[model samples]
Target: MTPTETTTDHPPRAGAKEWIALAVLSLPAMLVMMDLTVLHLAVPHLSAELAPTSSQLLWITDIYGFLIAGFLITMGSLGDRIGRRRLLLAGAAAFGVASVLAAYATSAEMLIAARALMGIAGATLMPSTLSLIRNMFHDDRQRTTAISLWMMSFMVGGSVGPLVGGALLEVFWWGSVFLVGVPVMLLLLVVGPLLLPEYRDPRSGRLDLASALLLLAAVLPVIYGIKKLASDGFGWLLIASVVIGAVFAVLFVRRQRSLDDPLIDMELFRNRAFGATLGIMTAATFAMMGLNLFVMQYLQLVHGLSPFRAGLWVLPMTGAMMVGMVLVPVLVTRIRPGYLIAAGMAVSAAGIAVITQVGGSGGFDLLITGTCIMAVGFTPAAALGTDLVISAAPPERAGAASAVSETSNEFGGALGLAILGSVGTAVYRAAMDTDLPTQLAPEAAGVARDTLAGAVAVAGELPAGAGATLIQLARAAFTDGLQATAAVSAIIALAGAVLAAVLLRRVRAGEDVEPNSDDTAAGQVTPNVVAT
Candidate 1:
């Protein structure tokens, strides 16, 4: 990694070539995320076809995220060592191959294995694309603008996944949803090398394999345990995952501190902007992911809508996210990013507060309006947080910073779904009597509580009078649970926003310099100052 290799420049500013590069790179990036949510929409269908037990269904859905969370930091470091562009090409090819495996998977076991492999490939795409963008756009306004587009693509992919999946299911088999990634990946495999500049750290050394393994040991079990608890409630495996997570967490931290070439710069935690920005990223994702589950459930179960219809109803949040992403960079020049973050979280809290008050019988208008407002609030928080994290770290370490930011995203979403989703399940189940009709099987009752869609399916199969009564009870109970969860999530979002505001105050005032200047070797410049 010579200086020439490390300093390969991109197109000037947000020119057509640069934006085209961003768009092309973001295509595969979007596909990876779309894979997550697209499968989510197909889960019921997948469950039926695969005949997976509830636990297996949970694994099929959650293992990708767990794998992604565990390996993000390690892969990010590897990209910086091996070259981000080369890794992106390799990852895209592997992702395409994994998609074929996922599409053709015969059993829940095979799908789970394929999904985990997909996670490995998907993990390589995120940090590399984000860090590449950071390297490509050096000017402040251009960089911020590129981040806005990048953020928009992420939110839009998440929002559109179910809609697209639902449409695909109507025309093709459930497996066709997995096939969506093939062409996009091939496009990346071709165009990415030409347009995307190659970069690697000259000073970076062999990846700390031991620390990487330690991180995997620490993070994966915890996420796996949470998924188990969400689906089946707590048990011995859950307990073991928690205990193992604690042990490996301590060990991983110690290893990182001692390593000559650490997987993550543990000391990045001391940077106020970087740390708080990570919190903003985490909290925003938590609220967004948690709300997505309840809102989809609310539309489908309480409102008696189909998956496609429910996706349509929640479309405004997706639209708002895109609109917000476009607006944030413009706002950053006028208002301090700290204020924008605080305001964004505050707005999201307001939306969540409105969602809490929603009744089982509320109209779609309320759902759409609430989610849109929340998205408007959340969009700025996400884009700005990414900006701050990239700005705060050295250029060579950009991949690692991006990885940490993404880890926060993956783990935060998993934690949100697990913890808050479990709360909803518990509340719903508790409200139902233990002595459900002798005719109603335990498995049937369990299905009703898993998701609103499942509840509606259960309702259709029951006797009319019994079905109506049980449906009303289930809907009310789930709404009650949502109210509780939304309130707590709103509080968390507000608290995170406040903390981000305070932490960013020093940096926002431009009263101090960023801590990591080693980026000088990687073409980074000081504020209003040149690199030495």
Candidate 2:
């Protein structure tokens, strides 16, 4: 190719208008993440008001995530067929309407339906925002920077979700948490059209309806099974759900290979950088989310802190993540992504090691320090791994690639929660089984052996000396569980670091792997590699 032809092939660097649009795009990204955790603190209030049964309450809490994970690929592919900006605006409007319905819902069933609608709407926002970034910031360096800022918004939203929810719940009713998204979605709908550019694959074929249904069938059951395993433990029903989901997934993949216009481009996974980055992202998220489950409970139950207070302690870690986000974009300009990602994982592993030293009491300082360190270490993987995934695909297929990236994260998080939670529960039960006071009745002993919360409740009915001994043993046993979970997390993070370093060593700074000949012929943009 001639120099001018090469120059013309790449889009120009993003200007100020693109940067402003990036700010607008971040609103929905933050809102979607916030929605994931915002309802945790509101569960008690909502249950009391709505008087939902146990199963209904679980549905009200979990249905949002289930639908989001299930619909991501479909919505992402749909964006490529339709216009990304068009889908985003429509989803935003839907999200706003759903939020209002949820906030004013009188019945648990209504709230569950509203949350489900919000989830489906929420799925469109993430991939659309990411794909838009891919198109808007064509310059490699600028795109990396934009992605860092975008990922930072998600971290901030996750960390603050509880804090925001707690604040709202303290003043308003449980429904107020749902209302928070209404204004944000309203703003997105009003301004999205004015600022964001709409882009879609001109050569893309019609979206197949069968593939869409197969995808939902495949994803929903698998995710539901994982969530159930985490909450209810091993069961024949959960195993069957997972098996059925796997069967549908196989059908979905086979159908994709036969279709002229597949919902997902299987070629994207054939790229080394794309596949490796996805694996590394999954591993990192697995460790982070698993350990996070214990840390939150540890702060509230062991440390005798309120929900709001626990959220406050989590802020330092979030602050560390924000600082890392700012730095990773600059560091990537000088260092290869492999080295940066590897180094970050190593640091996160060290943080997990520190957390293993935490005891049942007076562990506030240690837990905070360890989590902050972990956040700093993992930040590079969060920011750069996402950039690599999006960059691996041609711009036309960026939406599908973004959805794949998100699905890996969701799957990793669910897996982590299930496996690590099971391990911790097993350890806790073993310890409690031997330590329970012999004088306790069978019913009380069974309850105490089941969970830390149960032990605390059971202890209140005992005599002073017996209650004291039971409380002490229960806290110690829970601490043992926490230590074991952190140990597993440390090992996972360490392994991920090694994997990234080895697999991604050839990928240079500010550039993705070169597309193959087929990709080039199919109009993939060659990444501009920066000199080492």
Candidate 3:
């Protein structure tokens, strides 16, 4: 290649500086992901210290995800306009400040507000990281390797959040969980400018404020609705919120279609590879997310494991996922991408079937084993599906494509939590009703029947014999709920595997070109991936 020629056509490989930048990017990816689940393990401790009402407690735990999902698209496009590196650095600064505020929060309200701010900052971080990968790595094969490592970082952070938080909480205050991000962010702020190159779209238009608000209006209400359904079950208010949000979503798309520079070029969805890959990603996430929520509770309440132990137990699954991600990128050079993804999901479906065997009676061995298998099965889809999504997009529109991929996963998580969480809660309530100790007063029985956690708390105040009996039955009831949920997840995963095989059989990696296609039409590339 000529000295003045860029690597858009021919190969221009990443050097040592680019490799160092990937390491730098991993810091924020790991921290953001760790922050997402770290709060879950801190809930009991923080509730005691802050004395938040049930409602306030829910906000503290949930606000970060809600805001991050809501803002991803806007921030993604913003990066293309203003520059990815600039947006990343700005988000890191905001994230560091928010972390400190959250750590020192004196009141529940203060913490909730701080978490919300952090969510906004998190939105800015994700797309910029992925989009920068698209810009930095010009070669197809090298890009895949980069993305796998990046994806692994996020998975590792999520998998170990409890372990890290548990070890921290064992000695430090609950606020210590929030403090983990401070030093990481400070390091990124210092080293990022030195190693990371800036990339921006030369033809990008000024951001449309009205369209941005419309997109937020479209997303936030639906997320609020889903969370409402998860926490309180379906209601008229919840139904209305979802319907209204759908209307706004339609309006947002219509606005995009009219703009000279749309927030997201609608043509991206027309490519079969892009659509199919995103579909697989969404289904896989939807299946796993609900399972994760209930399993965490099961390990803590039923098995009575400390936070660290529970986190350690979850690592086999996460580690398998990490291994699978790296493994598939290498395998893709030999096997067809579609076949690999479809086969992976099929294996996960079988694992989900095995997970249904998890009962109240010493079933943890099966639970851990099945989930590890399931996680390994999921690796191909996570790694290659994202590869297709980014690779299928046109270079200028990579930011929008990255946002869409992340948004699909977020929406999948919300959908899983809302539908399956409600189902599991219903089953637990019904099953526990027959199992609660008869000698308990009506008030105590009511609390006991509400949830396994509530039952455990109530048992603590009972006589020794009654407490032991209540604990035993509550665990059994919760286990029954988990079995039903696992069955449903299995069905979802199987259906995804079949759909993927059909839709993407002809779609191979490193072979897309779109000019009439408005978004980035991917040809081939490498990886940088995350949610947190």
lDDT (Cα atoms) of all candidates against the true structure:
0.79, 0.87, 0.86
Indicate the TM-score of model 2.
0.95
Model 3, C-alpha of 196: deviation from truth (Å): 1.0
RMSD of each: 4.3, 4.0, 3.7
lDDT of 3 by residue, 265-329 (tens): 88778787788788889999999998888888899898888767888888889888988987887
Model 1 scores what on Cα lDDT?
A: 0.79
* lDDT-best of 1 and 3: 3
Over 133-161, each residue of candidate 1 has an lDDT whose tens digit, in order, gives 87777767688888888887787677788
Instruction: Write the candidate numbers in order of decreasing lDDT.
Output: 2, 3, 1
Instruction: Please give, for residues 220-248, the per-residue lDDT of candidate 2 as tens digits.
Output: 99998998888889999799999999999
Clashes of each: 0, 0, 15
Candidate 2 ranges beyond 4 A from true positions: 1-11, 514-532
TM-score of every prediction relative to native:
0.89, 0.95, 0.93
Error of 3 at 324 (Å): 0.6
Give the residue spans of candidate 3 off by over 4 A: 1-9, 435-439, 513-532
